[model samples]
Target: MQSSSSLFPVALISAERRGDLSEDVYRLKPGNSPDGTVELAVTRLGLAEVAESRGVPVILLHGSFSNRRFWYSPKGLGLGAYLARQGFDVWIPEMRGHGLSRRNRDYAKNRVADYARYDLPAIAAFVREQSGQIPHWIGHSLGGTTLAAALGGQYLGAPAVASVALFGCQVSRTYWPLKIPPVEWGGRFILKRFAQLSGARLKRGPEDEPIGLALESMRWHGLFGRFGDGERDWWKGLAEVDVPLLAVSAAGDRQDPDWACRKLLEQVGSEHRQYLCLGRRQGFSGDFGHVEMLVSKAAQVEVWPLVERWLKDPLTPVTGAQPEVLAVG
Candidate 1:
């Protein structure tokens, strides 16, 4: 599907390699929901030229408010395109309430559980069924939380995940008071009323979706450091996940503190986990805020390479097993 919005061409070395990247929309059958039969729409970026040569599949999930288009910015911050160049099948799925997937026509009907129970599992199953192999999973912010919840046994069974990478996941009790009040109460109330009136459906936008909705979603989950309260028991769910895990944090991110992320990594039962924090002093890529890490120009230089190295490593248990503990500095 062609986007009516302005196209900012991504940076690429050669035109021929650039031509190998293709984008398309896909519909998924999410089985059943009391609200209705749920169908999810996803935007896929398939690298036909490089994927066959590399022999790995990578899937990306975006945070709330933003859609898959966020990955294809003009600065070459597009995660899908960069991963495609690395010779991996890159798929970016539009969550239930956002983008073309808003087919329910009722925005209020959109639930976070749709991501935990439906979207992530469906994408994993799709990759396994189609490619005959389990793909590495990476998610940021809300997307990361959804993946963590899924891996923690909320949806699909464990062991189905090969390796998991999370960026900016807050998994501690202390990090709970950062929610912005008006956004926490007002956003949901508005969306609930909006969904009731619109019947859970909203049209695709020529302009960006309202910033209030994004702020509300962030606040509702305490991602902005206001109330620090979360809609789900994500920390409890995360403790149950057993897989090769990598947790990343940004020193400057208020939404997810460096300590919260470290504490989460320390608590995981899996011995096969690594933790890294990036900033200017660390000689990392960009001095980014919460959203910029995945979409910043320097992400290609600093962030993606670390992720690529971890993904390329064999999925074996780390030699020295450590009990799950939470540590922050």
Candidate 2:
């Protein structure tokens, strides 16, 4: 079914009820991208009882091998749904060939550079045009890395972004072997034979990632390599980002340690920024894992309220929102 929207060119796929919340799924074809090849599925969640105009927009970017389901589940649960019930107009975008976004002829070659330089800006523009306000962005894992790249490269900025929150995102983790040319090239050479890395095969997640992503990662971690594409130095560009920012890390997350996550936050030039360490040692109930940091019941009880508080007021003293034990240290 098709619906009319003065906002953007989107096909209304479904508008169903998830208890007291209204779930509207739209297929957005933003041909403005460089190649005009990707179609994105954006899921909008809002409170059924309230006017959508009353809700501010917040975009959730899911990590690699994931979809809108990362931020929102089918049973009407997840942070996206939680925010919607709290009167936030939540938008979860599935990146190219991920989740509901259909693959392109070159889907196997999609990279973060394309995502930051093109896809994100388009999503931000459409949301801002529709909402009549700058939207806040929240991204977990690889999604957060993409957000950093966009901000660092100047693809997404103040005119479109109200704030940004990165959950368990870090690109500075050092791998000594990848720094060696032979090691890096050899790995990429072997991976070139495959179109995508199987998440199920690796036991990492549910979705598969293109081989291009792996090759890109190897390049960034190569000797003398940095966080940006060959053109821009995204790591250095972080020093220019002035928006309110929050970087969260979980101690139990071995893949992206809290220390590495903190390094990513420290590079940001934002005067209003915070580094939240999620661990029992930090006074949380447990050492949250990468995925558990957001999706677990423990997060719902303790972490979600803190996130809600930050969104409501970016300048509020985070000290008051965190566990009192942190003050002692």
lDDT of 1 by residue, 19-110 (tens): 65755556665554454545566555557554444457777777655667666643334777777667666667777656656555434444
- Model 2: per-residue Cα lDDT over 1-329, one tens digit each: 44345545678788988888888777887776666777888888898877456578999999987888888888888999899988898999998888878887787888999899988987898788767889999999999999999999988889989999999999989999998899988998899999999888998778899888888988999998889998999999999998899889998999999889988988999888887888888888889999999999999888888888778886664554445322100
The per-prediction CA RMSD against the true structure, in angstroms, equals 8.6, 2.4
68 Cα displacement, candidate 1 (Å): 0.8
lDDT of 1: 0.60
- What is the C-alpha local distance difference test score of each model? 0.60, 0.86
Superposed by TM-score, candidate 2 places the C-alpha of residue 256 at a distance from the truth, in angstroms, of: 0.4
Model 2 per-residue lDDT at 251: 83
Mark the 10 consecutive residues where model 1 has the least summed lDDT: 4-13
TM-score of each: 0.72, 0.95
Model 2 CA lDDT for position 34 = 65
Error of 1 at 118 (Å): 2.3
lDDT score of residue 22 within candidate 2: 87
Question: What ranges in model 1 sit over 4 Å off?
Answer: 1-18, 50-54, 74-77, 171-234, 314-329
User: What's the distance in Å from true for residue 28, model 1?
Assistant: 1.2
